[model samples]
Target: MAQGEKGGRASRVRIWVGLFAVAGGALLVGDPAQRGETALELVGRWWPWTLLALAGLNLLRSAVPVGSLIGPLALGAVGVVGLVAVHGLQAHLVRDQLAPALLVATGAALVLSSDRMGLRTSWTRLLATGDVVVPPSVRCPVTLRAVLGELRADLGEVRGQVEVNVTAIAGHVRLTVPRASTVQVNAQGALLTRLPTRPSEFTRQPHSEGEFTIHVLGVCGAVSIARV
Candidate 1:
């Protein structure tokens, strides 16, 4: 799916989730006799996890659609496994060793396979040389990771406002999009973020129609999204 489409869907999900929470809160504050205690107990126990999974599903899917996403996805999976080992599996010793081992494995997988699908390997390799322009023909959402390099991706012809997941590790990434296109930015784990003037807050799109949603994760790197 295109970036904006995915973001729009996620946005709707957030809205519904928020409304549910508000309604639930109201119910909590209301007299308990109106409803049976059993329903309340059931929802109370599972509501938090349900919401977490609902949001996490979209976050992970949107942020890491490419094969490289497997790295972070695997990382999350390993974390869940570790939790199971520590609590469910009752393997405390394994917990101590799990983190370092998983880190090494994830790093190796990243180096070996940026995209196991092998679709955008060459295009991404251009990052090693610095300043690569995204072809207009490539309309689908893509994940770009930069290490000590730069990206010159243009979002002019992007029909869906480009759903590009950018990971900057001590690298500089630049995006050139249409001035008319509303650009929405969602940043996390960033040391710093420089966005357009009047840019909406994280996950907030003020001018969403025909806009781009760029998901950025920076580790000691910089990102700039300019309207050209």
Candidate 2:
């Protein structure tokens, strides 16, 4: 698309993210008696599915007038198989194996549906095994998708106003950038979405050059951004 359109879309994403943050903050400050359930229970349920929420965003990455059906189909298949294998039957697709299986299945679905999903290898990064590299020389906007995967993006070479969008459904995404990189963690989840005010937490926001903007959405996963 054109530069202005891309900028507009990016701004819209930021607006939605800001709205989500504001709503979450309001929920915390609002009354407990009227909210029905206790805050603790609400948090507990949300914590586990935090990163999984990224799947919703993924499905929308390349949408159309009708809608993006790949996400629901793929995830539904995974859910059905997982449910049947784990809970429906006595199948052992649970515990430790579940995460890996989901990752593999997710990757497969995306690749298989690449034709319709607008999944061009050029602008998107998919990691199924080891680290994911963000070309140090290229300064284009990109999306990173990792399932049962590990992402190590080197953004120290990025210049200009570039957007780095990340969606991790069931794995860890680590970003290595200059110390001056600005990190905005608008991750949607139930609890502890922001890096706690601790030095050990790597997802914490860092100083920025105001050029590289990072938008990370994780579900049932984690993202750590640190200096290169």
Candidate 3:
């Protein structure tokens, strides 16, 4: 059953890729005189919308978990901002005003986006290596950060609706969760992070009242969540 699901997902991904390639090919082969702009120019200005489309497509997929939509939603927001900056604003205005505003907005977004309600504890590793062991009874909404370092978190037991926010910059993070709890990983990074289609050992209602949820944000880094 898992194999069949995997195959179906792979096929769906291939279809999306093919469609994107065909669309790009059509643009490349079109007559630039009719459009008054070259294909490359159009692509440069419009590529961000593709990100928005991709995010929408992912959300439309049947297998995508609701908790996993956070990353895609953020991507879509980025796409919208990119489009506005590139297409709506003048170069001088973008550099002088929009850039600073963007930076401030990004910082604020990072702070506001994190799930901090009932935050149990926060851990940070900077230019060092560390590991965390979270007991089964631990509280929800824990935050972990790594900068130019490596970190591992072992979640022994997940009681109900446990939320973890992990961020890494030029670092690596590994999280291990118990097999008994349903696990969902919503991550954004250069590395591809796979969301669990189903719980392997213990089968329960997905997105039920209580499950393990991991939210990861990485820049030039890798984050992995494993069942054990």
Candidate 4:
């Protein structure tokens, strides 16, 4: 297929995926009883919403190329609506459902836009010395020491060598890197690692070349690395 056609198909896929995410979120918040469940439980049950939101956001940001303010505003709106619907109403209503659904839908739309516009990775390195939640697709290296808090890495091309450390606390770490990147993950926590199904020549081992380094220090949670 032509590059444009392939791109179009990817765009459509993002849209449909976003729609499904919205629908799934609607189901979770549609029932107030779901709120009775613990936050962890709810998150576990509706984890897909979070993934959908991330993918949608990533995609949307790329497509529209909007200012930074708009992204935060949209995220805040989704959080508010999700929280209100899940906590405010005692009785279930379509409106309650709509809030979460829209949140997911908006996320989906954002994802579609982002993918089309080709904005996939952030150049900034985020360090959170507390409980940090990360996506499933991240690549982690095993060279740095451990610390207290959570660390997450959204994968991209690695131009150099990297080291990550996880300190003596329980937290989460996520890494996303290009397939050509080398990764070493050394952790005491029960790690949940995610990688692309297809094998690539990039991340087969540690590299001697020095390009970029990603390091994480934390206690416990979950660690995920998605190879680009």
Candidate 5:
């Protein structure tokens, strides 16, 4: 199972890399100068497409569950908002502020709808340190957000499938899980990440007993997962 997961991840990465390379090649071959346009002008017209591509990638990374729709939906909405501001309306103010406004609104909506969304625990820390431990009785999604601090989450007692979303900025995050869990990690942005590679530690585990799916976003931070 571990080998299959690795193969799938590698293939997805290859596909995305190939698509980006092709797009880059096309841009270089079709010089903006030849079209009587500056590089900025070209970017102004094509930036929405880049956002759409990212939305698609995020959707692919998401699990096949209802909770997974949130990220893609937000990204797609931002991309649509960008398109409208850049081309349909051509409002500089809207282009500059609308996407961020929408993102903030989405976050607020998530907080309001957490109960309906089956979020069991939500933790946010700014310039602080803390730990979150999930007991075996809880079987819902968990969210961890941190900025300029450290956080640790222990899921060693969780008995079944669990979903965790983590966001960190200039901080460190450590996750401890049962060794029998089949852990799947999807991450965005630059992060120093470490996970056990030894087959005996995780690869040999049966997927039916315990599972952990984690989505991570980090900026100039580190994340590590330990199996116990």
Candidate 6:
């Protein structure tokens, strides 16, 4: 077979493999009782499986050259799984609900491993008022934070380092920047809306030679910034 054909075949196999991984992980971790519930209830009860499925689909679709929607969906799903698992683990010691926990762990792995949901050479932003939007690319250095709203990011290039700190009761935030930019953030409470902002720093200076924009949305909270 020609090189292009060989590559295409390999890509197809990879997509199938990714799909199988997701489905298998979901099945392995999911509870049959929870699966029988309504879709809304099922998601509320067993979000790990939901996240796993979406993450898998996102991974499979990424190889086929598609639009931008799946990328964000995968990111959001993984974020939910991470938040739930971390919070659950921290809140409970015995882990009475092992099934949910395992499902979440499996989904988290799928989300983290998928390239389509990972950060790329594009500007990134987050908006949150009640639901926190966690980017697969953005790794939280610290653990334990309360989220209430939404987070959003626009496509742009990022230069240098940006830092953010949010403490709000309810609201949303948006961020946009150039590609190759680095950002650090500390947040607590809920996020509600969507918008873009520049990266900020706390005690350091930016090293890049370009300017980046930062925006924060707060309902009844505070945001601090510095250069790094």
TM-scores vs. true structure, each candidate: 0.40, 0.38, 0.39, 0.28, 0.42, 0.26
Query: Candidate 6: where is the Cα deviation over 4 Å?
Result: 1-100, 112-209, 215-223
lDDT of 2 by residue, 1-228 (tens): 445545655786798799978876787675746553665665686655644544543444424311254556568667867787666754555544556545654555555343311222222334333333455555356666666555456667665566767766666666677666555554444132333233232333454553555566666666777765
| 4 or 6, greater by TM-score | 4
lDDT of 5: 0.63
Q: Which ten contiguous residues of candidate 5 have the minimum total lDDT?
A: 111-120
Q: Candidate 6, residues 119-211: lDDT per residue as tens digits? A: 222211112121122343443221112134323333243233333333333433334444334444422232442222432352223554333
Q: List the residue pairs that clash in candidate 3.
A: none
Compared with the true structure, what per-residue lDDT tens digits does model 4 show for residues 1-228?
245545766797798899988866776685646653654586797788766655455445434443553666678667766776778844355355546765565544443333222322211122222112222332334322223223344435344555544332343444556665555543324334222232222345554332333333343444466666
Residue pairs clashing in model 1 are 3-163
Q: Write the candidate numbers in order of decreasing TM-score.
A: 5, 1, 3, 2, 4, 6
lDDT for each candidate structure: 0.58, 0.53, 0.60, 0.45, 0.63, 0.40
Candidate 3 whole-model C-alpha lDDT, 0 to 1: 0.60
Instruction: Give the CA lDDT, 0 to 100, for residue 3 in model 6.
Output: 52
Candidate 3, which segments miss by more than 4 Å at Cα?
1-120, 188-210
**Residue 102 CA displacement from its true place in model 2, Å:** 24
TM-score winner: 5
Best by lDDT: 5
Model 1 whole-model lDDT (C-alpha atoms): 0.58
